[model samples]
Target: MSADIVFSDATRLAELIRTRQVSPVEVVQAHLDRIAAVDPKVNAIVTIAEGALSAAKEAEAAIMAGRELGPLHGVPFTAKDSIDTAGVMTQRGSPIFKGRVPDTDATSVARMKKAGGILLAKTNLPEFSYWIESDNLLSGRSNNPWDLDRTPGGSSGGESAAIAAGMSPLGLGTDLAISIRGPAAQTGIVSLKATHGRVPMTGIWPRAPRRFWHVGPMARSIRDLALAFSQLAGPDGLDAFATSAVPFDAGVGTVPDRKLKVGWMVGPGFGPIDTEVAATVKAAAEALKNEGHHVEEVHIPALERDFALDVFNKLHVMEMKPAFREATAGHEDQMYTMAKTMLSLPDTSMEDYIAAEQAAERLRDGYATYFRDYDVLLTPVLPVPAHKHGITELVVNGETVDLTYLQGATVPLNVTGLPGLSMRFGTSREGMPINVQLVGRWQAETTILHAAAVLEGVSTVRGRHPSI
Candidate 1:
């Protein structure tokens, strides 16, 4: 198979298959070939479905027979191990769950398959899908496709690495906090974290508390991300938090006709951002202004308060403690040190937890007010580019900062249950990918994708493939 076949986006491949220009079997074979060449270097793929090629051949035969086809129609994709696939091992990067196989497909997985997407492999993740780096006792570590010594960002790191390395054109990943967007930024790919509860979280490991978790799409291009999302988003009766089914406008190649009203901010909302990342975000903002969009520097008043992170941390821990205890009860030694430490914290008081929840409500309302005046908001995806693997301390602008600082811009969106998309904006002097994130109102992913498509065309970050 040629490199061109491996790099084609899902939208393009689907069009080819729809028009009989390429066989579904041929598309699946190209991805399998690319995975064979690159998986050894990135460790992104945990397991390859035994007979995916044969299944693809069957799909091709059905297509040639003039049978009805689904939206994806034989496009190959991967899923983070946390999302279960019936009859396949969904280890979830932990030894405790090793060899664990579910009897049912995750809602997201089943939806993609129903749309004719072939699941070729399962990607890696952090142990119990807890950490920000994809390393655990079961499948080992998933490395950055651009540089093995650096991390690809977690817990969706494996999905990001696989897509960045051309192993898969698109994939499914879960985001609880910054998991999806972080890895996408680090790997120079495009990923969307839909409004919480927009996609069902039913078969995901570490089944997150109520509505904090989300399942979304990761891909090389915004169009591909939107394509996969259209198939994945909707209510699955199994998840209580799932939203009622609503028609999603895929908006793949559709550009908004009118000029946009963009509100841009670098660090004030989430604290001080890295100088390099701030510079790139400013440049992106200026480029939007150049495109005739109205751009202005704006501050989110809710972020000025000190309790943002405190509220999020407390609420998260309160909801997570039960599951963490249940999962790690007898196997304390098998978990990551950070997970162990977090589990060891004293139980939070009900008074404090309630206060935090109230504070969160206020923050959400504040963002709702902010978005009322702007079409979209722009910020740095991370305070810095991908850091060295296993190095927790981050030095930014000559000052050492805690790892939690990296979550500044990302965590707020999770708290508000808003939609955010990450796209590669530029590369640092050291050649690492730098990304900018666009946050939109609830269920407004279309506007975010449109802005991302415009920026992708003008930025220097386009078409740079990672060497696996």
Candidate 2:
């Protein structure tokens, strides 16, 4: 029974608690037990909240006293170590800020707490949440739950691993490039990278490159992602970028399902994708077509791999490094390798920075044009399935490519400030999960979610779990 409790998703767990079939205490304790038994092998969870069990007991008492409960009244969730949680340790997977604790929660964290979600713990990330793999001196690297030797996909890798292994039902993760979608894809979970400023980033670190950073939910179920997104979106007033008041249509709650125009790509245009990963995306498109949606292979312009990385690097290198340099001034030797290398790179010329920004605008224009005709664009979340930890290069579709190409499909959406969701679509030959990304126009999460819901119902990978 405890095993069953731990494996349930947040939506189902909330229903069980609301119906009195299970108490809040049972739900929290079950996951705590699962973490104890399984987390040693994965190392996904970095810090367990000191007050979780006590809070769960209080939730149980309130329910027994006939008090009304919020949507996630008793369900436990985790946040990436980079996100703020008042009074809880948020070491950010780096030794520079070890023992750090914030006095106030991030806007997203506070909103989740207000909606009755419990913060069970903080999960791991790359040092300062920067690299493509989750590892740092503060907490060792996090291994994938499906294959212990492979990576879970970083910056949000730990959150993805915990959700996949049943240690947490839902989680909050931030994405700059591929953090949320890529990690969720590698682990066979569902996650969203909402439109820029859709969710606040009031208390997150490395606040430069402010225009590109996003915080959203990563969960085992698409409905849970939608639920959590609705709770976290809207202007928090503290974050200057969160000035818009857009709400997720959710495409649920009595809206009848209808056909959607989906453009699916296995690219020679974006980057080289493994043959198997391409097939999985095509299969997902066929499933969508069978459901009466208009699915087709569409060509998009300005998707050069060079342009994507150039724009990201121009802003990331110039803007994101100085803050870290300032933060770790006295403790240079303690910095992680990737971060140390990032700070040591030669300065960018002003002319190059301007050129990259122009290229970014073209990339945005290309997506804007494509989205006008198609409701959503479908692509593989990563070029291949999770790769072994510390392995740098990959042979993708017969070409030896730099691992940075993993974000080929994802980073473009971030550059455009468009919304994208990554969900489990198929399984690899090794029995590992494969995911595909669905990109939608600005503030069109509902359209993407509705379309994904249709395909998800017919996907063979749904509800499958890692043996971990």
Candidate 3:
């Protein structure tokens, strides 16, 4: 395989295949070779599909016959193990479901396959897709491509690691609290958390509380993300919450008509952030302003007024316990400690759950009001870069904070059900990846991508691969 072909984005690869410069079989084989060489070190891919090469050959035959192709024609990609793939063992990183294989593809997986993207493998995740680190009894741990000792944030860590290492140019991931975005930030890739219910969640594990779950694309470039989004967005009829709401175009090649109005908030709403993280976000904001966008520091009033952390934990724990009970009942020995603790929480009273639901609606309304004045809101994806494996608490700017603090800036958006995108902004003094998130208005993924694309153009960190 040529070096240029291996590093090219999905957009370029698809274009090449369309024009007959390269065949689909060649492209898939190249990624397969890369994965064989590097995945042992990263532990990103849990199962390599044995039939991927044959499928690529079929795609190549269609091209030779001059048949019209789908949007992602001939591109190779991976899916998170939590998303079911027909005939493949989707262990979800836990030994509890060892050797389990679904009879049909998840809605999103089928969509990507129909678009002519070959699924090369199923990536790793936390047990039952629960934690921020991707490790479980079945597949072991997924290490960061940048630093093996540090984690690639979960539950989409495996997807991000594979894409960052150039094993695959595009992949699919689900985000509840910060799965997709956090891993993208940690791995220095780009990811989109489409508006809640915009993408179907059928066949994904832990499928309750659809309000917090989203399935979307992860890629090395914003344009490739746009390409993947075009194929994955829309209602699949299986997920009840996957409404018929059509997403606005992502504006892949078109330039913005005017300067964007951006709001910047660096630290956690409750407190200050680490100095280096704060600086990285500030630098991104300054770059946006220099590019002619109107950038200003803004406060989230709802965050200041609400017990954001407490509300998130209560709602998450209440909704997750029942699902955990059912999915892990027979395999308690295989579950993680945190997963067990969450299961032990007393069931929430109907009254308390109702009040929390009402509070969530109010918070959503508040963010709606805030977005009325600004095009997008910006913040750090996490207080620190990828932390050491198995360490939950983080020390930021001399204050000790828990893992909940890692989601401080991210969870509120999940509660509000807003669209968010995470991309690499700068590297930390420790050489870890620093990420910033851009939150857009409801169904406004285009706005976020446009801002991210602009950032990608000026930033020096774009497409910097890890050595592992």
Better lDDT candidate (2, 3)? 2
Query: What TM-score would candidate 3 get against the native?
Result: 0.96
Question: Residue pairs in steric clash, candidate 1?
Answer: none
Model 1 residue runs over 4 Å out of place are 252-257
Candidate 3 residues lying further than 4 Å off, grouped into runs, are 250-257, 268-272, 349-352
What is the lDDT, from 0 to 100, of the residue 412 in candidate 3?
Answer: 78
C-alpha TM-score for every candidate? 0.96, 0.98, 0.96
Rank the models by lDDT, top first.
2, 1, 3
- Candidate 3 residue-wise lDDT at 437: 93
Top model by lDDT, which number? Answer: 2
The Cα error of candidate 2 at residue 439, in Å, is: 0.5
The lDDT per prediction is: 0.86, 0.88, 0.85
For residues 282-391, what per-residue lDDT tens digits would candidate 2 score against the true structure? 99999999988899998776785345865777766888878878988999989998889889888788999888888888888888889889888999999999999997
Q: What is the C-alpha RMSD of each candidate to the true structure, in Å?
A: 1.7, 1.5, 1.8
Residue pairs with backbone overlap in model 3: none
Name the candidate that leads on TM-score.
2
Q: Give a tens-digit lDDT track for model 1, residues 1-468.
A: 358768888898899899988888888988888888888889999999776897799889889799999989989889999999988889878777889988999999999999998889999998877778899888899999999999999989999999999999899988888899999999999999988888989888777665778889999888887888888888888888786565676874234478988999985667667888999999999999999999999988888764466677888887888888888889887887657867888777999888888888988988899988888999999999998988877888788877877777898888889999999998988899999999988878888988998898898878899865
